[model samples]
Target: MTTEITIELDINGRSETLTLDPRVTLLDALREHLGLTGTKKGCDQGQCGACTVHVDGARVLSCLTLAAQAAGRPVTTIEGLSAPGGELHPVQAAFLEHDAFQCGYCTPGQIMSAVACIREGHAGSDEEIREYMAGNLCRCGAYPHIVAAVRQAAEMAS
Candidate 1:
């Protein structure tokens, strides 16, 4: 037996209506239903920030966010972070320039979180950026570069 519900999400500046099982997390709905695979599934328990996404301009763990909980809210994934014409967000450009990722599995989430960290004014210093971004783990030990990327993006955004 299964129960399903419909939800309307404004993802990445696009509006999408999805019918999903109640148990379907926002991550599954985005990756499975919408084919937005940039948001990785890591430590599905929400301990890892791999599934980070912005819900109404605030960062959230998609793995633990229920699809229904996101209904009628603007959801922004890694795919939605840039302009339509492939214009990289400042954070994205900084990440690329700094080579903040090694394995790359955690890049999307890290980028997403980095954007939020700057927006939330938590990236004012290296230690602040590190603390705010601690949730997003890089298995390849790229923390230094990640911090540098956030710092660079923050400086550029100012």
Candidate 2:
């Protein structure tokens, strides 16, 4: 018989208890089990940053992170970035102002990473922003605009 473990996760400031197989990834737990689908799954091997989410304020790959491993930790998905009053996060706003996305498939990951990039103090220069955001792939060639958005958001934060 397969063993199922019940774990409680703090997601978006809410407590969610799930009973699932240990193999279930945090992506599946958020998208499949909890109905929070903002965190996309791409290049499930972790090469692409599409499945990025913040665990305890640090970004991580949900695709490779087992749900159980996140138990007792705070998980913030794309949906959690917005304020309860419906205001967009600074990075989200900057992306809109800069038109930093095209197909939008990678925008969530990019935004998530950009937030971390700014918070981590790595958005000082264009080169630094590019280096910090290298992990996120934007097939639409929105790198220039993305860098601009990150730059703007970083400036706003400072």
Highest lDDT: which candidate? 2
- Model 1 ranges with Cα > 4 A deviation: none
Where does model 2 exceed 4 Å of error?
none
Worst 10 residues of 1 by lDDT: 1-10
Candidate 2 has its poorest 10 consecutive residues by lDDT at 36-45
**Per-model TM-score versus the true fold:** 0.98, 0.98
lDDT of 1 by residue, 3-81 (tens): 7788888888888998878999999999999999999999999888999999989999999999889988899999988
Which residue pairs in model 1 clash with each other? Answer: none
User: Over the stretch 1-158, how does candidate 2's per-residue lDDT look in tens digits?
Assistant: 77999999999999999999999999999999999988888899899999999999999899999999999999999999999999999999999999999999999999999999999999999999999999999989999999999999999999
What lDDT score belongs to each candidate, Candidate 1 first?
Answer: 0.93, 0.95
